[model samples]
Target: MITIPFSFIPPKILERLSKHFLNWGAFLEKLFPFLQQELGKANIKISAKQYLAMSFIATFFLFLFLGFCLTIIFIESGKVLGGIFIALFLSLFVFFMQSNYPKILANRRIKKLDADLLGALRAIMIQLNSGVPLFETLVITSKQDFGELSKEIKIAVDEISGGVPQIDALERMALRNPSPYFRRALWQIINAMKEGSLINKVIENIIINLNKEQIVQIEKYGSQLSPVAMFYMMAAVIMPALGIIFLVVIVSFIELDEIVVKGIFWGLLGFVMFIQFIFMGIIKSKRPSLLEE
Candidate 1:
C-alpha cells in the first residue's frame, strides 16, 4: 500500500506480489513490533508489512534496471561473469539499504528527541509549577518550538482530544518513544500523577537524573576517544605519510612501471579514505545522546 517515489513497477503488480507472497508477510511479521514502535516515534503512518512490500518492489525494479545496464556493459566489454557478479552484489546491497531505511530514520528521530529533551522538560516543569493543568501544560509545550519533542507532545494531545485519557496517551508515548530519557520522563510523570505526588518535583528529579546520566556518557565517550585518537593518528596520519615516502623512495630505486606506480598510489589513497570513513563512523557512534545546555 506504499507508493514509492518515481516507482517503475505498477501499483497493481506490486500489490499482487506483496499479497500473494506468503514468505514476505511472514518475514515482515517478525519485524513488525520493532518497526512499528520506531515508526510511531517518527510519526510515519505506514504499517511494517506495507513498508516491507514497498522495499521488495523497489529492490526488484532497481535490480532489474541495474542488472540490464551492467549486463549490456559487460557483454560489450567481454566480461559477462564480472558484470553478473557485481550486479547481484549491488542489488543485495540496495535491498539491505531499503529494508533498513525505516530503522535509520527512527534512529535519527531518537537522537534529535534526546537532544531536545531537557529543554522540553524544563518548559513542562515551568508550566506545571505555574498552576497550569497537566493537559494544558502539554498543549502549551506542543505549540512551542521544541523540535521532535513538540511534535510528539502534540500527538499525545491529539490522542487525548480523541477521548483517550491523558495518562493513557502519555503512557502510550512512553512505551513507543525510542529515547530512553524521554520514556523515563514520561513514565515518571505518569507515576507522579497516579500517586498524587508533586509533578514539578518529579520533573526536577528526572532532569537531575538525566543530567547525571549525560555526564557519565560524556566521560565514557572521552575514555573511548583516547584509543580511537591513537588509532586515527597511526592509521590516517603516520602510516599514510610513511607509506607515501617509502613508495617514493622505492620508485626512485626500482624504476617501477608507470601502471604499477599509479596502481600503488590509488591503492594507498583508497586505504586512507577508507580509514577516514571508519574514523568518522566511530566518532559519530561515540557522540553523547544528551540535549545541550
Candidate 2:
C-alpha cells in the first residue's frame, strides 16, 4: 500500500513516468559484469569523456537492480500476479527517477550559470575591450572559478592549447549548455575573427541580450508567484482535507447505509487522487520545459 495516497504535494508519480522513457534506469544492473569486463578492462578518457562511461555504469546498475527485484518477486512472492505488478511498479519508478537525474543537474547548473553570467560577461567585455588578447582573457576567466560558465570556458581554452580548433571547442560547449544562443554567438565570433571582423561591440550587444534574458526570467517568476501559491493551497491542502472531512461527515452524521458510506468514501478517495494528478500536471507545466522529462 502507498504510505501516502496520490496527491498534489509530491511528484513521485510523474517521476516514475520519466523512468519508463529512460529505460537505462531499468536496464543497467544486468549489464554490469560485462561492462566491467569490457569497458572497465579498457583504459579510457577520464574527464568530460567520462560521461559516456558513467552512463554505462548507470545503465548496468539499473538493469541489475531491476532483474534482482524480478528474481525475488517471481521466486519468493509465489503469487505471480501481485509480484508482477510490484515488479512493474518498481521498474517504472526507477526509470522515472533516473530520467530526471540529469534534468535536476541541468536545472541547477543552468541557474548557477545564469547567476555567474553577468559577472563573467562584464569581466570578459572589459578585458576584450581593453585590448587584452582573447586567449589570455579566456585564461583569466577560467582561472577565477566564477562557476559553471567559467569552468566551461576554461575547458574550451584547454582544448585550444591541446590543438583542438577553437570553433569546434566552443560548439561543443554550446551543445553541453543545450543552448542555441551560445552556438549562434560562438559561430559568429569564429566567422568574424577569421574575417578580421571587429567584435567588441558585438560582445557588448550579446551581454545586453543575456542581461535582458535574466531580467525577463525574474519578472516571469515574480508574476507567477501569487497564482502558484494559490494553487498550492487549493491543491495540496484544501482539496484533500475537504475530501476526508466529507467522508467523515457521511460516516458519522448522515443516516446513510454502511454500503453507501463505504462507496462514498471510495469514490471521494478516487476523485481526490484524480484531482491531485491534474493539479500536479498543471504545476509541472508552469515550470521550465526542460524539466518536463
Candidate 3:
C-alpha cells in the first residue's frame, strides 16, 4: 500500500473526524470491523471516544431541558406527581429521539452518497481512461480536492487497502448508502469486473442514466414543493385574512355581547390554529433535509 504523505495526513484525519459528526450512526459501521461486514464503509476511522463524548453531551443537556420544563409545568398546573411522570416519559422520549437524530440524518446522507456512488465510479473510469493509475486516481480524487465525491472515494480506497475484497468493499458502500439506484449501478460495475470487460462505455451510460434520474427527482421535488408553498400561503395568509374579515363583519352586524357569540369566535380561532399546525407538519415532512444535497 502507498503511504499517504505526512502533509496530507492532517487534512485527511480532519475530514474523517468531521464526517463522523455529520453522520454518527453511519460512523459506527466504520468503527467496528464486525459491523463493517454488515455496513457500507469499513475504516474503523472514528474513535469510539468521539461518539461517547457526543452521547454524554447530548444526555446532559437534554436532562437539563427536561427538568426545566417539568418545573414550569409543576408550578403552573400544581400537579407535581403528574408533572413528574409526564416529564419522565417526555425526557426519555426526547433523549432517545435526540440521540438518534444525528444518526437518522446521517443515514439519509449516506443513502444520498450511495445514490451518487455510481457517478464517482464513472469519474474514476474517466480518470483511468486518461491514464491515471487506479490507486492514485483514488487517492487524488478521494481527497475531496474535487469535492464530496473525493471524500467518499477516499473511504472506499481505505476499505480496499484494509484487505476487504473489491466486491465486498463495493457492497459495503452500497449497504451504507442504501440507495437503490446506487446499488444497481454498483452491481453493474461489479459484474463488469467479474467479466473482465472495459468499463468506459458502461461508465458513460451509467452517468447519463444518473443525470436523467436526478432530473426526474428534481421535477418530483418541484411538484411536491409547489403545492406545499401554495398551502402554506393559503393557510397562513388567506385563512387568517378571512378570519379577520369575519371578525369585522360580526362586530358590525351582530350584537356580540352574548356569551354564545364570543364562544363561536373563540372556537373558530382555535380551529384555524389547529389547521395551521397540521399544515405546518405537512410542510416539514415534505421538505427534504438541508444536508441531503
Residue-level lDDT tens digits of model 2 in 205-285 = 777776676567657766876887787678767977887787787668768788977887787678768877877766554
Best by lDDT: 1
Candidate 3 lDDT tens digits, 192-237: 7779876666777777777776677667767897878787778767
Best by TM-score: 1
TM-score of 3: 0.58
For residues 1-293, what per-residue lDDT tens digits would candidate 1 score against the true structure? 34544347776677666765556755865856676665565566866676677666767787778788888998977998788788778877876666666777777788889989998888889988899998999999999988888988999999999999988999988987788889988898899989999999999999999889889999999999999999999999999899999999998899999999999889989999999999999899679979462
Q: Residue 140 of model 2: what lDDT?
A: 96
Rank order (by TM-score, best first): 1, 3, 2
- Compute each candidate's TM-score over C-alphas: 0.85, 0.57, 0.58
Instruction: Give the C-alpha miss distance for residue 165 in model 3, angstroms.
Output: 5.2
In model 2, the runs with Cα more than 4 Å from the true position are 1-80, 99-112, 164-172, 175-177, 254-293
Cα lDDT computed for each candidate against the true fold: 0.82, 0.59, 0.59
